[model samples]
Target: MGLGKQDRTKAREELAHDQERAERLPELLRSVAEAERALDEARERGALVEEVHEQGVRLDTALTEAMRAAYARERVLVGVGGYTDRIRRRKRLARPEIKQATQVAEHLLTVREAHRLHGIQQAPRSVV
Candidate 1:
């Protein structure tokens, strides 16, 4: 009923879709492999020309790309799920608490202007 719940549900749904895409990717790869094998066999038997094999190779490449795309979709879904978790954690943190926590040691430094302040540690960036 709430926005948070809705967001969480959407993220979960995306995650499920991503998992399904990941699972299907291997099957698509197998189909490409089978096509490649068939092309090779045809070439050996002289039933098909080089052009036929080339077409098969193109199809294989397309399928490989499709698999990559599917995997990427899955990653996006998983990232959404991670985003949902991050949002929940952020929601619980008070604004003032975050502001205080975000301050760096460098900001507190009463620098001895004459002396090189080498020992003061810097704050770790959120991304790092």
Candidate 2:
């Protein structure tokens, strides 16, 4: 069956949105990279725990947004491919970005764990 007018309109809108997102992918990736660098620098400088945590949060948000943009860009690519082929292509396109994000996340987790340990060490011990 042919698509209804409303369906066609919605599809067009979605395509347009995906195209915009594809155009923005580079900027989003740059933001993610910048946030990751800032977080790394904060850790290296031994900044306040709160400051490091804030940086980590920023990195997390940037990474999430960049990932969404990447997925959107992938969706916008039209070609002759089976489902598995498309899935493989998407994974290939995303692998590097995913690796970078994973590294940042792991580093943030380590920093958080260290902070938690430090807090525990600073807490006063009560004698039973």
C-alpha lDDT of all candidate models, in order: 0.49, 0.61
* Model 1 misplacement above 4 A: 1-4, 48-58, 61-128
Q: At residue 128, what lDDT does model 1 achieve?
A: 44
Query: How many clashes in each candidate?
Result: 0, 0
Q: Write the per-residue lDDT of candidate 1 for residues 1-128, one digit (tens) a residue.
A: 34487788887787777666656655665765676566566656765344554645555454555445454443543355454666644553335543342231122222211112332122334474
- Pick the TM-score winner: 2
- Per-candidate TM-score against the hidden true structure: 0.40, 0.61
Tens digits of per-residue lDDT, candidate 2, 24-89, equal 768877996798788788878888777777777776677666666665655555322212254655
Local distance difference test, candidate 1: 0.49
Worst 10 residues of 1 by lDDT: 105-114
Query: Candidate 2: where is the Cα deviation over 4 Å?
Result: 79-128
Worst 10 residues of 2 by lDDT: 77-86
